[model samples]
Target: MFCYQCEQTDRTNGQPGCASAKGNCGKDATTADLQDLLVHALKGIGQYAALARGLGESDREADRFILFGLFTTLTNVNFDAARFTAFLREAATTRNRVKARCDELAQARGTTIQPLSDAAAWQPGASLPELLAQASTVGIQEGLKKLGEDVIGLRALVLYGLKGVAAYAHHARVLGYESEEVYAGVETTLDFLARHPTDVNALLSHALELGQLNLKVMELLDAANTGRFGIPQPTSVRMTPVAGKAILVSGHDLGDLHALLEATKGTGVQVYTHGEMLPAHGYPTLKAYEHLAGNYGGAWQEQHSDFAKFPGPILMTSNCIIEPLPLYRQRIFTTGPVGWPGVRHLADHDFTTLIQAAKALPGFRETASDESITVGFGHDAVLGVAGKVVDAVKAGKIRHFFLIGGCDGAAPGRNYYTEFAQQAPDDTVVMTLGCNKYRFNRHQFGDIEGIPRLLDLGQCNDSYSAIRIATALATAFGCGVNDLPLSLVISWFEQKAAAVLLTLLALGIRNIRLGPTLPAFLTPNALDILVKQFGIQPLGDARTDLAMALAPRAA
Candidate 1:
């Protein structure tokens, strides 16, 4: 059909008539159409939020819709067709409200607008095959361009970051902690994004603004996490499978990690973190569980190979799910939006399936005993050593802080992240999360003042740690976040990475370098805007880039 969400596209590859085989990322015809509809609905809901704002409407429904819709669009989060259709129905309803409000705004302003007045336009009917056909006929390339890929891409980026935030927000909300301002940003930004036209300059401004909002979101989450679970501290998690049956938990879900830890309290099964889930070990509450074992695998992309080798059940809590190999397919259980048709899914955070599956799967034999790796360097933990850090800085013992973190992928060029982390000077500190951290987490980068140069800060979702550390450093230096001598060299693989990058941008943290390649989804115009307005740059060679990053800026 007609869909071009990834950087690789048939239209751009000299295959104008051929609708398939353009993107190397493995999404097919149906997946593409579903994604488009989801995006369209998200935009519609965003438009509605803007309308409600004009009327000074304070509706929680609008906020939830924006948050859920955006979260659903994130990569590897939601793959179930039935769930997507349900979301489409809800979004259509929200879209109508947005269009109606948009029309009202136009009328009040004495300007004519194309009123997306028909609520029924988005309503689904029995013509399922026909609709799919229609979508196929709809020029995918043309529609994406019309939608302003750059603007749409960037907005999607912001929404994705919020999704990561929402993941944390959801946990905090359940724990009786909520950030009203974050809720407001999630609503207002989505609404604004839905109706607003894509202007490079405007998006550049909004991108940074999004960062500012995300800073607040991260703060709210940090407070929630620390307040509920106690401040994070340095923790060393093992990397080997434990004796008896075990369940491997992946993604960024502390509550689930805690739940699993609680459920397995007396059970013989052990638990380990995989991918982004590795950071759960840093939390004081969760780490205290004796059954919580060490990390099993690397980032999400390696699942095809990594999951296959595991001797027990594996739980996928969120994104970065690759098609499971047949060997380990039965042992794989997914929760949250991560789903595959035949795999067991635990709805509503229910661990019945997880616990049962852990028991049923052939119990794992202890491969490594009591071995561990250090984790849990949130702002608090880092700050605990802030005096030493500052002293090191003053003594020229710690020269730089390289935040080498983001999503991991199978792309050949992806090795750059590992190379970059490896090449980082011994006097520097490497803060990382997400799968990208896997590149150099195991590498021996030497140490500065008893601290390893490469410090694992949990998962990609733990990018919050990087943000917190930056803000704290800035506070200590009595300057803004940008004024700190911190450099963020990020690698992006999916929408979540996109969102994290936007959060960085939203915070006005500029002069950052991103790679292996910019999202194919972004148009040149959008790229230009980011480069000129935000001073954002793409990555060069690791050594060269490191030199540029470490070089003192002009006064």
Candidate 2:
């Protein structure tokens, strides 16, 4: 197995599923085997949901379990060997219960079928090659139209979207909010993927369903965010690391950032935001912490180099972790679902260890001589200026709105985003979210009537903010959302971006230019359906794309 689709691949042009026989990071054969088993177990859990549906027993716990389990398997989230094994055991138990119930139903109907739960019963000592051979014969990868690949790819994208939903739902759960529909979507999607073969129409329907489900998930998260932290206000966050002690927290979890800020309070330890944490500066409750220092790095993909320059400890509260560089390895810690085998792991919302580590690390040395870039243009802030924005548009002061935001990574062509931002028309306003915003965060695009060229709207999860702003803009203008003079040029690198994209589609927004190469997981047919149905086009050259985006739309 060989995999290297992420930014921190040890080897260039590596595989996505597995990077070498035993992942390049010395994951070893045993770990690889367990990871596969864990995936299969989760698949089993999803299959069980169908049985539950049959018995009319759908509930919150089952829904949460499926979403959380799939999200945990996503890259860079969970790497703790022991914790994963325990999760697999739990999955096995759930699988057994599902099988038992199915068997009882079958017996009552005077029908007999093999129990899906018993992994050993299916095939005794069957070689992997034999299973692969049989599966290959019936698999959806061989055809003139490549229908199998297309269907598989569509399902894969939907599964990835579910993973993103789980991540956000889990975050909301941590913040004391839960959505039953989001969880049900997870179970339903899983059941569909586990049992069905590649079918073009079926996959297309699922993709759209994914879009619909993600919209609800984002709304649930948006409610949780605004309820906990007051609506975001426009504010500038310092780009320089503070002098003396500090802890740089990176991840999409605002709750975790708040908790860490609280834990480090009065400890003389300055708190610095990194990656997704940059948005914390915009939140009323979070920014109130005077000790919260400026942002420490550029983006998630740069952690290998950027983290090395950090003068203090770094706590990763979520995804986008690429194996830490040696210089920062000792000072790096992970909490929540994120983990590195030997790295210090904090469990069960316990950030005390993180606080202690920050104290033990070398004090943060002042790095910034002056202010660099300003962030924090969340939904509320944008809405506050909605009238001015509408007037500017009507008055021909702002020509276009470019939402050049999504995930960022070390992919070669990703520089296209920076070039695009640099080349966007002077009369345009750029809105960004997630680490993708880093590309042009410092790029001077000048200003339009006191508003900066680029507006940062927080993290990947805050894509909801952008959606809200878009909808509000449409409402203010009394026109359909797609009728607004706004365009989205998004770059996706992970599951969270997938969820956000689905939400945009659910809202019936169209003509989105997405790039840095389409996901390797997307099949050709699925791509075609997207183009035909939603007018989703891939980005070309920076100049060409920018020109096309700024040009007048067809009547």
Candidate 3:
């Protein structure tokens, strides 16, 4: 498949990508090629749409499609080759329709314009076989030898960051938030890429610009989440399953989870959050559901064992879906942009069939022992106690703040995050977010003064919360964010985490630690640029890194 998009990419000495028949993420070559064609189709649209905008014509429909289409191609989001083919054909139609409109406007103005560009002029094949042939010229590795691996890597970085932006924007749109700026940003970057500039500096700038756009989208999503459901507050969630009919919902979409909660209310189908949805309990509106039981599993990587062990049906609401075992494959369902070849998908926010299936299956037969973990320490919650936090730091009760968080996975190197959290000095506060926290979120780190040493700050997308807290702490301490006694030890596994890393680098945040192993897509040259520009470093010994972070700032 030749895919190096996620953290689990093959890292052999000669080839640092999955170039075999199947990708490390289980994506087959046919599906990977189709996805490449879909993106190429999107770039074609951008090529024409950018020209169309110059003629005082714009396409809002094309803009929205660009976001939604790229979102479907993100890692572990969609694996159906049929869907990729449909999107490719649909993108061609969307581009041509927009071009036709622009032409009409030009004709009405009594103006003759130059002929359509090569990208806009090209047409897709009429049938599946023809489309398959067309995909060969536009694959991700189309010009790797000519352009050099560094340029290809930089392009992939910008494109993948854009994918992350689309995923977050899609979530916000589902909750009734939309922005023309985000659309413009996506179109502009795609248009830039279509023109084929190979300047390393220019490509790096594009990456950081995508990072800035990602920040805006993250803010929109944050508003959508906190506004729809009240701001997240500190709450203890039950880790043990409750006795009743149960349905486990995983992924990052709060709106989908909310719909499922509303649909199953009073029907005696007890709903439980899993994976990324574990943070739902902190929201006042979601917590109001009496049947919304505790979380059932650990991170997304453990889904095979976790989902199989659960007695009831399982619903995947977003990214990071593993192939379910035969024991529970039929019982697993998908919604939103997430999909699988055979899994039943729920659309229109309706969960009637799913609820029925839940009732039909054997649920938790008896209550498990009581166990709970604290969550919901979102931006508002942390800032709510900013005064106490500041006072503790000034009094030397809290020596440092460790922002150890990111996407969690099943790799052996992932244990480093757990160890890092466990070994943080007793005087430091170990704050976390995303599924990675599942490693040690249950561990007792004790509190510094009145603040809990382990503070869970929602999901992967909640990096906004961490940013807000860091900025506020910097403001409170009368120093820059880097000058504060805080360190960001990010554990990345996918594109969303990649986008967040770019955001930090774009903001000039320095000395950040990223692990378990760098992205395989990062060529040595591109990696050098990041390490030099941002003072970024790969993870080393936790104890050693901890000492460096604890060292006093230069006067």
Candidate 4:
């Protein structure tokens, strides 16, 4: 098996991918191959489903399936091959379901409609062996002879970017947000790939278009989250756990967290947010839970150690779930797109089993001493204090603004983000989003004019807050966003971050400093295109980058 979708992908021996029995992320070959096949099958489904949409026939369930199915294939999300095998059958069934609807619609309208022969009519074997055999024809390497590595690289970029779109869209979707435009974009892009276009420029253009599409998805998600949970407010959350039967909810799904919270109410099971769920504490509807305790851990990468030590059951709601250790594997439960082979899987928003396990175990024996972290400074919160921020900037009390955002990973180079934030001058305000803020967010930076020097903007999905704040700041100064003192120092570890980057680029934002490392799928030529066209730069010395960003611009 070969896979290279995340920032931690192996590049050893002059190779660009993980081609071994196990991926660098601990994904076994069986799981990795099945993920690739799942991707292949999704595209096959898209080929037909996209045609149906074009004929004015669309299935909401099929569109939603595309979102969840592709999200499971993302790096560090799902490792259960059984899940992918099931997804393959689901993809085939959904494709046929949409295909039939489109056919009936076209016949009534007397419009001749044709579907792609390969994806529409393709069939994979029912058993594991047959599915494995079918996977051989549907991998990226299968087209290397005809498409070449360069074209394949661009295709992978588009596919990975699309995966990010799906993830954000799914998060919004679960909260009752739906967009026909976004759904059409997903299927339309997948169908484009099915047609096998090899032009380098076309592929790159298509990729940026997906980036444009991601912007829409992110906006919808921002609205869904705020509309339901209420705009995140500036709230300090306790890092120490309280004594009780506790349930730790991780991953990016607020919907799942809300469900678990409601189910565990009055059960003597206290809920604590972990990883990406930490910001949920700032939402009034979620934090209103009498037993909803504070956060219990840091980034998603630290789950193994964190989960082992926590004396309660854990529930993972979405991405970046590493392989669970045996110590807490039995107590760990996955729901809604997260799965591990041996870990118990919960579905249909059920948390009874998890709550039961939590009650059976000892929670925090004693409440730890109080220590807290501030989060939930989403756009509304920040913009609420906008007048003060603008005044401080005008008076030169605030030197510049640094927007450090994106997913956090375990890579050594990620420390650059820590040092970058640490070194920002006292006169400058540093705004951070996503889990990457964990690296240095705990560092104490006092406020200027009643505004904390370091502002936390919720999760990676809350990037809309950052964008809105930037646009508002630019408007206040009567200048373009790029003309402002803001600079984006982003650390990308997954496809969701990639989608955010494309959104920034498509908006004509320039000079984004991206790291811990470049995508393995971006060939030298593709990288050059981004560097030249978008003014994108690789992360250099954090100190040097900081100095460069703070330098004066010419009139």
Give the C-alpha miss distance for residue 396 in model 1, angstroms.
1.6
Better of 2 and 3 by lDDT: 3
Instruction: Mark the 10 consecutive residues where model 4 has the least summed lDDT.
Output: 114-123
Residues 1-555, candidate 3: write the lDDT tens digits. 467889888776486887888888888888887887787778778776776787777787888788788888888888888877778878989998987887797798888767644566657778777777777776666758678789889998988888888888888888988887787777787878777778989999989988898899899999999989989989999999878899999989999989988999889989898888889999999999998888989889889999889999999987998777898999999998888899899999888889989999989899989999999999999999999999999999999999999999877688788888999999999889999999898898888878999999999878899999999999999999988889999998888888898888888899889988888889889889888888878998877877888888777
Best by lDDT: 4
C-alpha lDDT score of every prediction, in listed order: 0.68, 0.73, 0.86, 0.88
Superposed by TM-score, candidate 3 places the C-alpha of residue 365 at a distance from the truth, in angstroms, of 0.5
Q: Where is model 4 more than 4 Å wrong at Cα?
A: 115-117
Weakest 10 consecutive residues of candidate 3 by summed lDDT: 113-122
- lDDT (Cα, 0-100) at 451 in candidate 3: 94
lDDT of 4: 0.88
For each candidate, give its TM-score against the true structure. 0.86, 0.88, 0.97, 0.98
The numbered model that scores best in TM-score is 4
Clashing pairs in 3: none
Candidate 3 to truth, TM: 0.97
Instruction: For model 1, state the Cα shift of residue 150 in Å.
Output: 5.8
In model 2, pairs of residues that clash are 2-18, 2-19, 2-20, 3-15, 3-18, 3-19, 4-15, 140-148
Which lDDT tens digits does candidate 4 get at residues 390-430?
A: 99999999999999878898888999999999999999999
Ranking by lDDT: 4, 3, 2, 1
